[model samples]
Target: MSMTSILLTILGIAIFVVGLLFSIAWHELGHLSTAKLFGIRVPQYMVGFGPTIWSRKKGDTEYGIKAIPAGGYIRMIGMFPPGADGRVEARSTSPWRSMIEDARSAAFEELEEGDEKRLFYTRKPWKRVIVMFAGPFMNLILAVAIFLGVAMTFGFQTQTTDVAGVQKCVISQSEKRETCKESDPVSPAQAAGLKVGDKIVAFNGQKIDEWSVLSDRIRDTIGPATITVQRDGQEKTLHAVLKKNAVLKKDSDGEVIPGKYVSAGYLGFAAQTEIVPLSFGDSVVRMGDMIENGVDSIIALPSKIPALWDAAFSDGERAADSPVGVVGAARIGGEVMNLDVPAQNQVAMMLFVLATFNLSLFLFNMLPLLPLDGGHIAGALWEALRRNVARIFKRPDPGPFDVAKLMPVAYVVAGVFICFTLLVLVADVVNPVKIS
Candidate 1:
């Protein structure tokens, strides 16, 4: 890498880290604000984990920053109630019972006489649910806003039916050759007298507007076809017999995967791309598509672990769709900044990346697992259900469901997450994904 490239890479990583910190702060702000709104005592609101680097006491809350920049949390007092008798000082012989009692004791360790009313567990189940849901909801809102802003205001790169370049000769995708050989045949587009800057008006009696539609049609049709073009404000027609040729297939991102090829009708032309601003409705639809894709990617993550392991340790090529860690994403951001596109395009791409990251955060945290926001929400819902069931049967109140009882399960979940994160980190460091 050149010095300029190295500097851009560092700058990109710095910007991404800053954005991550802001996102963590934003997520924690939701929890803190909601807890305060519900009269719950929040002792400390810290961004990131580990030892505190900076802190300030304001009223009942001590806000601070931590040394680790991975994630953050807020400490809410009375997250779990004491035993059924409302007494924290208790002991049990059974290991599981001991675990439950220990968790209950620590929850109210700082309990005061007047703090009973301000306890989180003392609130209504719905209020507790809201408090837990608020953090992920904030991230969702941020993702939506960033996506809409980038799609509607900054626009996206779109391919048009206009021709940018016409290949001179046919080249097989498997050959991996850029230059044409002596025996290579002239491309159908070149033989048909197609020129750069020609706007394809129609293809095989069908009106052509979008490049994707036209390209698909051209790829599917291998016989003779009439291509109508508008060149220099004058309409013209060209006849060419499309040839069945080996062509590289591209993914949704328009990147060609190695070892993948499809025999399609060759047009031998590249489409011109432009930054096209989408309408509000279009932007919303596109955002929905992006969200769906993100969900799919998350669902498919576990299935990619084997491939990730292979890439990290063995001599295996990293798939383009491999899961990327923060380091990989930062490297991608750096590469995007150095792309030859306009500055606005780079900014928009970076924003899209951050937006997707936020979206991932929202989804990941919403999993109905322990230590996540969704886990607390699930606990609150379960508590609500239990109380309602008890009331229906005219039985005694079950009281707050002690989520702290699940501490052991939460530890397991955290361990799994740490292992997965380390795997991704090793893959990123060893065989990182590239934009090119």
Candidate 2:
């Protein structure tokens, strides 16, 4: 790479790293503030992991930054309840039992004389739930804010009714060839005198405003048709004979499905697209679509494991929608900065990437598994349910749910995550996915 290119790449990566750090700090702030609100003593609020680069002791909490910027945490007192004997019990010979005892011991390792009443597990179940849920909730807020900012100002690319291109001759989609044959029939669009830059206004005397609506109308017609277009500030009517031909299949949302063919009324022109600002309601609808797509990506993640493994360890191609890690995302941010577009567009694209990352963080951390925020929330809710049940039956309280006993499961989950991260790192270095 050239020196200038390298500098741009570094600048992009640096910007992304800054955004990542701020996101991490923001998420931890939610936990720290809520924990303090509920009178739970927090000892540390670190934005990253490994050796601390800087730190300051303020009141009961020590806030700091660490060397690694991948993830972060806030250390709350009494994360797990005491053993059945009403204490942090001794270590046992069994590995799982040892894991539980070690975790319980660490929860009280920084215990002071006045910390007994401020333990996290000693709070009401609802309060504990809020403390754990706040972190991921902060991420969701950040994602929504960033999305709205970009959608309302910088705008999103959308298809319009204007014509961008006109095919000279019709070609069957099943043929998968772009060359025009001498014996082939002229395209309906070209024969009807359609030209690039003409704005399609109506089809067969029916008014049309959106490209999808016009596309659907064109596909459903197969005989004589009248098209109304605005050309050079003048409205003109053009006639053509629609033909039934094999074309690419489109999904319900009007997006073309690649490599799939279906027989439909063929219109041989491509619609123009431009960045258009969206109103609040339209933006909200788009946001909902974005969130639904994110959830779908998460649900389909496990099925992509075999593909990821093959791409990382074998001579297999990496799919475009494969899961991306921090390093991969940073590289994409770099590419976005170097695009041949306006500076505002580049910045908007970068912010969108960061927003997507925050969304993923929110969704991933909310999985109901050990070592994730959702796991603790689930545990707290379960505790509340059982306690309420006991109260209803006039029985004794069940006490706090012993979450530390699941230390072995947490370890397994962490192990799997680490391995997956390593694999993604390897693939990123050797077979990186390029956005452009």
128-198: candidate 2 lDDT, tens digit per residue: 99999999999999999999999998899999999999988889989988889998899999999999999
lDDT of 2 at 183: 86
Q: Give residue 436's lDDT in candidate 2 (0 to 100).
A: 67
Give per-model TM-scores: 0.89, 0.96
Model 2, backbone clash pairs (residues 3+ apart or across chains), number: 0
**Local accuracy by lDDT, each model:** 0.88, 0.91
Candidate 1 TM-score over all chains jointly: 0.89
